[model samples]
Target: MRSTTEQTVQPCPQCGTEIRTDRRFTTWCSACDWNVDPVEPDERPGRVERMRRGIAHRYGERLLAEMTGGESRRPRRDVAGVLACTVALCVHGVTVALLLAGVLLVTLGWGGALPVLGAFLLGLAWLLRPRFGRLPDDAPVLHRADAPRLFALIDEVAACAPTSGVHAVAVTAEVNASVSTYGIGQRRLLTLGLGLWEITAPQERVALLGHELGHFAHGDTRHGVIIANALHSLNSWRYLVAPIRNPSGLEVILNALYLLPFLAVQGVMMLLDQLTLRAAQRAEYLADASSATAASTEAAVALQDRLLVYGSAETFLLRESNARQVRDRAKRDEPEQGLWDRLAAYVESIPESEYERRRRVGALRGHSVDSTHPPTHLRRACLLAGPAEPAAVRVDAEAVAAITAELADARRVVARRVLRG
Candidate 1:
């Protein structure tokens, strides 16, 4: 017989509300509605969660979501199957063409057809095999000591994934997280950026992890590796053949002929890549649903909001960095150009007149990528207004202005340093 004590009522830790107690673990506080205990202690959540919550509490939810959810997961592919089909098709096509050419050459007492066939085989082989580097065995792990609560939340979310288990986790300074499959079996790696941790909530962090796990569940990691290898092989063949000069007009024609196989292979690979990307986008939606299911609708909404804002800022920073790199390269290439001259040159290169250029640049300053993720304003509006009647979230023009100004200042600093050096 079951003990009645397991069903006894217990006082809510926060608001003094009475709640039934069936499990040994502490649950939600009924009175104040605060969480009484961490969601899952045995599972380690790591730094991604802590950074997310800290960003949310400081900058509000909208900023956090913008930052986290910008990039969707990698697309899915069937590497082995695709490679086999490609090889078989190429061999059959080349063999039939070579045989017909061989008959013509034999009747005319010519010997070049055999060489052409040899070159084609070599090119095809080169396009199928690719070199891959091993991921380091001792990559550093980011400690989650600073955000214990957030880590606990991640563990709870991870626990919900039944078939595939979560593996290693790492943090980078960029605002990104990805799950990669590198080995022969179920082995995988989950990488989260330090920038991701810097700007989201606990719930949002779980959403990010859940999204990554979705990639694993859908076999995207292995597919990505296969696609990458295929692309690499194609690229390698191009590199090898680029410097070799064709001696005969026939060689030039043969070069064009060789391109057909290359194009056919690449076209298929690209289509597969895009298909994978679309699948990844759908996975994001599913992960978002999973997050809502595991936590709450409100929590899922808040997570999305936080990701948008933060992800935008991070992308802006990266663009700024790239611009600086380009500027530095320009300065190195032309040391004689004056600072004012370089600035003037840059302004002149804009597609508009000086006045219009300034205005356009100003307009672009704080605005996030409108095309990348669903607009932050739209996402927020959807969350606040509900899915059926989704509206745009109200954005403060002043806040955008402020962020733009800050980025402009950073740019100016970079410009000064480059000019001085």
Candidate 2:
């Protein structure tokens, strides 16, 4: 006689729904939208494939949205705008201070103008100085035995454009890579994080390195530093004026005489910083396009996807931690009190809710006047919509040679300036 047997049932990995089956392979859970396939894993396409799809599908749509809304790609300003704003703000500030001092001088003496002029000159010098002293070429190098494959891929992409030769490359455990220019001649430095290396495909890695090269080729390093310096000065002036604008009774009495000039200076600087921020946003778009053109559209998409995933993960984790903290606080016990007293005390003691916390995080990430880089979503969109032609590729040997020669000359010029100082 044959005996009847019962088989065990497992839940679907994708959606968490229970499944009564004898099948050995399971990939999706219908209930919770999870992937349970241990061998196959989740998202079989890898980083590059996912990015390519995202660029093809979502990049154009997002770009259109931002363009129609008149939003900037990045939070920082371009070099020209930064310079214009810095000069305008400084000039206006000096003019106002002088005008106020002139009135005082008429009543008293003529010695105050000299100090005011000296202060103005000092502010100008500070704003004009290069903020990035030297490139990260001097950063310690990390060499792992597994770096050969990654290096080979980078070499292939660099060979595609002669001017794209990397000046320095280093590996770190961080999940990001950055390209920067330092000193005179704008020596390039490329940094890659181990996290990025582990997750990114060969093509995706090439695209990232290519993006850094694009920044170098477009003179973004020098321009970015100039803009950053100008912004820093603007911020400093803003802080200096805040106390004067909203002074205490005693402070107000002391500053009452110079209030007009202080207000004028603050207003001028604020306007300049806003304009500079606008210009920087435009430059970010240009750089994104340069990167896309250097590589293929697919590669650009892949790079953007990787950035978005990393950025989103960071944002989500922060939000989750804040939420957990709130939950923990709410569980604390409290003594009973009168109705109005309890109400007031409860309202005052309540921490930020999850929604409020998330909103704040979004706001910080969405719009940043102080940041030197653009928002991740906007940067990705720009790359997707960038030029299809490979015009940004610097594959010409002569051109690379010229850039190298020019870099050497720039170094000499900077050295001379330093010596003179």
Candidate 3:
């Protein structure tokens, strides 16, 4: 209901320091970071999240040590990778066995409940079948004709990384970017998040591209269809076998029947996670190295610094959306033009000291983009510790301008989606 710029100053009860409080955001003491990120009841992590956090902290430290201790920078296959692949193969084998058993029962068993049992087995087989990754039908896609300048930039990064290029590029409203394969053909796709792209400097954008492409270069096991689908199947199996909290007579029997299977699936999932965790971490470090190789160590580290403040960027977007809602309710005029411009200005206004503080906070909390990756602070340190290579693919201001123009329509659509929330 009020301008985001309108703020009041008050003393932080914790530290007795003056802190600016914006009406649209939490009132937090920047000096002491009081209430900066208050823990809400719902924000408390579940058992699985706690386990993942522990794993992240443990392996994050180990990988950081290995990288900084003059260990080979290149990613190599180890026992963990082999075990992970074997586990995935076994999972697939089980699915095939289910299919064959279902077929045999249906063909050979001609009486009693055998037909129904065979059908049940067939259903299980279908559920456990390996899933081929697919692109989201709703997300906007940019082909070479649609965004030649952008594709040129991606191609440049691909060449620099010496990785096979993507077949298509997809854009989304997320505050992240990633690369993955899709379809039976296993065509590579690059997903560029406008939220992140709008704030990145040209060289930083190159670094981002280089980093995602690096995953392909390093053969990130987690991204492979076999492993990815196995993980998916395991999760699905867990969900299917999970015990119901509230069960009636027959349902109670069903729930009791599911308990053993639920525990078994959980154990298998945990084993798969443990086996693959080290290789996944190594893949990330190698990707970061590739990023530094293509976009320079400075830009790679800068990209990580930008990642630390994505929460702030998301907050800014929320505030803007709320402000727009208030204006609409009051029948006050406010055009939604230049949303990306406003976002860029807001991020650019952040002081370097603020970034440093967030980095420290990330380290304190072992925060990462996701549980799969190391802490952002550790990734930044790894990049900084490596050689400061120059950029292999540079996107100049003119190229950036061209690419921005090409993405103009997509930006408007994404901005509308964000504001609508």
Top-lDDT candidate index: 3
Q: Give a tens-digit lDDT track for model 3, residues 134-220.
A: 887867888889998888888888887778778888888777999988889998899999889988898999999999999998888
Put down candidate 2 lDDT per residue, 1-421, tens digits, no spaces: 1111222367665555775432322333434434322233234553323433333333334434664354643334356565664675565455456456545544555566666665555554454434554634423442323244334444555554334655555544345777765567756566765345334544565567766655554444225554445556545554554546577899887687556756765665555544443444445555555455556667666666555445333333344335444654544232211222222232223222212322333333343322445555556555555345453333345543443343333233322222222
Task: Report residue 269 deviation for candidate 2 (angstroms).
Answer: 4.3
Q: What TM-scores do the predictions have?
A: 0.42, 0.46, 0.88
1 or 2, greater by lDDT: 2
When summed lDDT is taken over every stretch of 10 residues in candidate 1, the lowest stretch is 386-395
Predicted structure 3: lDDT: 0.82
Q: What is the C-alpha lDDT of each candidate?
A: 0.44, 0.47, 0.82
Better-scoring candidate (lDDT), 1 or 3: 3
Candidate order, TM-score descending? 3, 2, 1
List model 1 lDDT by residue over 1-421, tens digit each.
2233435476766677876543432344434545533434445432333333333233333433442455332333456446544643453454445555545445554466665665555555545444353443434332345333334444555555322544444444455677665455535666665445335444455556655665555443223555446545545544544333744877777667677665665555444333333333334444554445454556656555445334344544454446656565645443322332333232223221222222232233212222112333433343444233121111145533442343333334333444333
Better of 2 and 3 by lDDT: 3
Residue-level error in angstroms, candidate 3, position 30: 8.1
